[model samples]
Target: MADGQDLMERIGRLRPAVRAAGQPLHRPLLLLWAIAQAVHGRPRQQPWSVVKHELAPLLTQFDGAQRGERDVVYPFWALQRDGLWEVADSAELPLTSGGRRPTFAILEQVNPLAGLPEADYNRLIDDSTVAADALSTLLVRFFGANSGSVVEALRLREFVRGPIGASLLPLVGEQYADRKKIAEAYGGNGVMGITPLADGILAVYSDDKGPYPDHHIPETGWIAYTGDGLSGDQTLTVGNKSMQEYQKQEKALRYWHKPYNGSWTFETWAVVIQCRRRWGRGEDKKQRREYVWVLAPVPSPLRETWPSDVVEALAQDDKSVHDDSVDVIPAEVVAGQESRKLSAQERYQQLSDAARRTDGNRTNRSKPTLVERYMRSAAAREAVIIRSEGRCENPACGGHPLERTDSGQPLLEVDHVNGLARTGQDTPEFMIALCPNCHALKTRGAGRGELQKSLVPVARKLHRAMQRGERRKARPDGT
Candidate 1:
């Protein structure tokens, strides 16, 4: 029994060499060394890319060699070409004895590392294997760290360890910055958190922090509030009402409420910030504006770390965990599904059914009917109009408030500032963009005279006030 156990242990020790012998020889020197090693009864030719992929995390510690570089192929190929063992055709290069694959019975004779003391040999194998496994896992997880929130990705980085953990921090940080860049790309009138500072500078907070009804302005272009003690205040206000009136507006907007209250959540705030910056009027240029809203306390609990299982699972499959934490629900409920039991067959069937349903939904039985196409085209037109801020081309009515008419197919209709039918010109300058309400009122000759009289004076007054307001504020650097 003792001899048999010893023999089993010896065979187990030869596994790494056996596995290494089957890899491809890529680099010239390494390939030559591996081939020589194989000829001289040493394991040779493990897949070079596979080994490097496994070692990437640890190899990052070495100078000048990044994880997943082609340079790693040279060393691996050299090992095979050194003639440690004869390479035979197989998934792995098998040990050759008189042109035939050898059995496990000859394990000791074919292994060069096998001559080392058992303890040392085992330790080396264990360390290398651990490093390789860690790197491979990290590379997988690195690609999966695309959370919408920086905090989520940071939490994920903390749960990961060794090479994977190191790789994730920078990758996740880049992702976070990319999200900020995207938000900034939206430019003007983006959703911003405005904290009133006693100083001349406005403390513009990014919408990435949490949900609020206000627009998020970029910190880079914003006037830095130089007022003493202003930096300490991080809170901001939202909406057009006074503080008391805003408070009664319900937690639906403050905390994300589902269904009816889609715009009232943190995610919505992030999206709004992105949208306003990208598509808001005067967003591309610098301007001064005053906004008001009551600052409310954040209701959700702060997460200290990302769930370990989530981080681990996401590293393997990113899309699976994309919306994991976006929902406003208790973490305990989210965790329930992880512990649930389902047989392999049942899980397969469930996934398969989901795929079939998704495919069925995408199938088009007929060309989109004329009405359907019109509705789709109308929706696309509305999106374009919104993106353009519905600015009227007609100088006379450029700033007039516009509205949508059809609830389901709201189309933007412009009325002639100088009546088109009356004026008889095809020029865009004669047309004024009007909201559905204003367009209907103008077309039907209801309140058309009143609206025309009211808008001109209002527009003039607002323009003068904006100009005066812009001049009154002290510019940064006191210039």
Candidate 2:
């Protein structure tokens, strides 16, 4: 029997060789070698429990040995656990069958050869490695072909090179196959299956292969074909010939058509709506109603079926309830913006004078003075106050106020509880922000009765909340 020292030496030598045999053989070979020795010359095939039971005791004895921990050793032990090998089954032994008892001699037969022919086996391994790498590269390139133009180019090259090139190219002809497999595996739109044309090109013919609908091709641009290849007596122009043709051919075709007075032209339609809002006296003395004038475009098909009321409204100068009109205006003239009857400067001057008088003739009542000098500065401060309040304070209005407008700045005037002109307190608490329509109604003495009753209680609650927050800050630990 080999001594324990001799067995240890043998195992140490085998470890390096097993590891050098590549990733696949590393653990399996180590476990196989260990199991072979433990079962050497045994007639009874031991169960995994028996093998593990035998090996477990040695772990403590070999604890401080040169080898590592249980993780390194458990893999070898697991081989028996998993049924890769068996303890010597006496019934299968030739000697037990009346010939000769199978001894340690069979161990050599079962174990991998210590001196495996390196060249022959290594060549097979190397070829497999190269094939795997090639397949990966081919798959990457095939997936990268996202466009029809790219697919067509690949097809052309494959056709020119013929069978030999196709075999060499990673996924030359199997573009659709790779795409479909990848899509299915990853759960996306399946590969686009395009038909190969005679000119060594591929064209998308249908949407059957994809998960989604195919691109729409207008009837005018769609071409029909009768043959398997591009060449045929019956052919339809699926694409604009000029757009598809080579640059050289494109210029040549243009020159040929020039003498025939054939030219490409473009046209567009304009749909305009003219709306005007007018208020007039009603039959009831105290009631006034607003009238709306609407002019809308009518499509060519609906021209004959146009509503008579709409047409008559547009024809008359008076305001109408509804109107629709269709008139042909030259495309070039319609393309430009319509001319304004009044200039901006004239409107600005008129608005400035009106605003000055509305501001109660405040000192320095110029246009820019009223706006940039006072109103803009006040609007900025009001925006800050609105943000601070978090919402509209008016009890009648519960909506959050997210915006403040310069146009509504006149209505957002700082209103003092005792009147700004009288109290002179410009503090945020003294002033309340209100929307333009709401502010107008308040000034006209419409909603003040409700607002005055609500504001007092809201101010008292807010003041108490501030006092409670101050008290909490003053005393870090409650006494």
- Expressed as tens digits, the lDDT of each residue in 206-312 for candidate 2 is 32332222221221111111111122211112322111221111110000001113221111100111222212222221212222111122221112333443243
The TM-scores of all predictions, comma-separated, are 0.20, 0.17
lDDT values for all models? 0.28, 0.28
The local distance difference test score of model 2 is 0.28
TM value for model 2: 0.17
The residue-by-residue lDDT of candidate 1 on 308-347, one tens digit each, is 3322322332111111112111122224555765432333
Q: Which ten residues in a row have the lowest lDDT in candidate 1?
A: 270-279
Best by TM-score: 1
TM-score of 1: 0.20
